[model samples]
Target: MSSNAAKLIPVFAALALGTSAQTAVAADWYTGAEREIPRDDWIVAIDAAATVTSNSSAFGAVTATIAPVNTLLDSGPRVRLQGVAGTYTYPGTVTGQTVRGVQQEGSVLFGYEWIWQQAAVAGYVGFNVRNNELSILDPGNPVVGTGIGGKVAADIYLNPTPDQFYAVNASYSTQFNAYYVRARAGFAVFNGVFIGPEATLLGDDFFNSWRVGGHLTGFALGPMKFSVGAGYAYDRVRKGGYYTSIESRMAF
Candidate 1:
């Protein structure tokens, strides 16, 4: 299993499950990208999900995040932090065997935003730490290890008309020997409601894969918004399968 994917499991799980928002302040539904903190606003969010792969592997995960709306040290950049935990189950890592394990992760990020009457744009960079348990099926498995990585992301939101919305979010991150890329876009059906397509490409020296999907986002209540989607996934090492996701976003 890719350790990096474990840290990101919450994102895909939410996309398929369609429950609870991820990220903190500047929430991005796909890949859990976060916008720059909105003016004078703080946000909190929790995300949970479960997934079963074509390999007969099942996974469950949860993530909690928090951020202050204010800039860092009264500067131009916004800061956010996150914590995550999850478990993985593989029915046949070896012949007639089942494997299960748990993982925990933390991340910190900084963002900058630029706004215009017609559009808003933001970018972020951050570091992450992850601890994972090697599969129980392995003898003398490395039970736990600390791994570190960094990510960069950019997002844009556009309002062509008072009631029209269009947006895109994209990011790339690298950890240890693995890297990840995600991009998603949406066009409003009305006011704050939108539907869009998304793509994810991830891999390392040992593994590589891709997922293509489409999602629907709906009207906001207070500061929260939601989305649901389905997709096909192909892994270089594990082959291919179908999957789905759901997500919500809120800022207060």
Candidate 2:
């Protein structure tokens, strides 16, 4: 096996071990508590993560989102608003130069969730507004545009044994010159704790990327929950790249 492929084995194993060992109280919000699923009339959440390529170039972003009503349950639909900011650093097409790019975006989404005997599904569609700064070499130029995006996610808590569950989540977005899709899956190893694989396909006309990796998710402390993942990436036509990401959510 190539050295890079071999490196991922240990990382995946370690993540699995960490996930399996995370035993929380069944009453915890994520472990089939009396609530079954975590929900709130209003929720405030933040997601932050970074991805790095084999060339040492990197991309990082932070997003803050809010839900104004109870929408994650079998009840009714909900509306959400979000803001994001991120930076990208990469080797310039020209030799001996590094290019840095910045982006800021805002979006509003509306979606609904449905709950069955032991499962729930949710989906949402939204409009996005964004500002993309050109390059570190040129500080005053930015391209601004509008776009559309949507997301779909589902969770199934095992019956007879609420400690185990499976989940799938996916999202897609498109603009005048760019579009991307991301998807992930998870299976519970312990009450409220899960491990799974994830993939991403994102980029623009000038650049694109594909990545796959395993993840650990649903580590909750009170009303807060966390997730983390890492994997190798194939950037445009190049290989040997890798990426990692983490996120946290809070419901109130």
Candidate 3:
């Protein structure tokens, strides 16, 4: 790997170690608690987000996960069915022209989750199929074609206190050598509402990007949660731009 890529290893390692420590502490605390364990046999979660950047690029993504054995609130081995799709627009080879690309991925992963009163973590590994489409030839585009490959993913949620919350999500796919990681932390300002900072890093064989911003998260209405974020984004191709995103998640 290039020196630039090697520099990221430490960041990833620190995050992983922090997650493991938090999980261990939460588990130990729950083991001695008298509260009854919560249980739900099935869960379906959906998340969608859209981002527009100043670099004349707009992107959108949506994902759904179905856990048949246990819900996200509880711990157990589960069969996870996931689907992800993303679309984006970028500058084309010809000046003043634009190109669009779409990516779709499907995975059937075997996963195990551990839940505690204040924290939860889950890990998954599976086979995935990815498809990519480009409206026109754009050598600047990172994702090129379709392939079948292996994928690994992890999710972590932490609520160390009644008024604080943190979440982390990371995933990597062998297809096109793609990877994404995001982390956010918030403090409750009102009932069921949190406001905080967020960061993201994502890349592929030919593209890399990072974002730093703030978010309003955990806005709950009925069974759905909503979040909105705005930040400064920098990418190898686009240099720098501002971005805004809105996300929604539902579990039932």
Candidate 4:
């Protein structure tokens, strides 16, 4: 991780904590009919997703959020934890041989969220640890060496009308100079189900990729929500390929 990136961690942490304190103070000021109704004392949410591309690259991630104050349905502070793993195949140094490399990452973040009737935004700052293993060094792989570094992330959701919604998720880490961003918009087709188009951009020091796809989102079964997406992907290293992904989330 770069020293400059590591330096930013303290600044972000201070800002996040300051904002949470202000929010708590403001909440206390409300009284009588102006006071917000409490929904739940706490909430825990888990999300898992996996993606596979035609170019012999695959990735999976899981994230969990613990909000002692129930941030999912209300504004509050939360602790976020995430784990990611990926494998990439590339040409080996030896002729007619291919090498598969593995990468893993874990992070913990402190964050606060603000919610409105139709929109919500959240920001997080934290530290991350990453590891990469390869039998042969491959320049085509994005994630390179193992390191501990700073990380930041943001999520936004907007519901403009009863039938339409949009969401964006982005994150950056000093480890291997990696970054990821995804945006999607959906239109309701059923009571609570939506279908939409989605796009993603991600890269690191050595590799970059973009994907354009369609997704089926907001499908609820019992207590979980599920989504599926498929699309075309283009990357500097892999050239071009197709990708498919599935994601599920549950909160309690």
Residue 203 of model 3 has an lDDT of 83
Global lDDT of model 2 = 0.51
The model with the greater TM-score, 2 or 4, is: 4
Which pairs of residues have clashing backbones in candidate 2?
Answer: none
Alpha-carbon deviation at 101 in model 4, angstroms: 1.1
Arrange candidates by lDDT, descending. 4, 3, 1, 2
Q: Comparing 1 and 3 by lDDT, which wins?
A: 3
**Cα lDDT of all candidates, in order?**
0.52, 0.51, 0.66, 0.71
How does model 3 score by TM-score? 0.75
Residue range 46-122, candidate 1, lDDT tens digits:
54444445643444444443435542112234454556565654444345356665767677777765544455566
lDDT of 1 at 235: 74
Sorted on TM-score, best first, the list reads 4, 3, 2, 1
lDDT of 4 by residue, 22-89 (tens): 11112435453344332232266677899999989999999887776644556779789999998988
lDDT of 2 at 42: 33
Error of 3 at 187 (Å): 0.7
Question: Looking at candidate 4, what is the lDDT of residue 27?
Answer: 47
Q: In model 1, which runs have C-alpha deviations exceeding 4 angstroms? A: 1-75, 89-98, 137-144, 158-174, 220-223
Clashing pairs in 3: none
Error (Å) of candidate 4 at residue 174 is 0.8
TM-score per model over all chains: 0.62, 0.64, 0.75, 0.80
Global Cα lDDT for candidate 3:
0.66
The Cα error of candidate 3 at residue 82, in Å, is 3.5
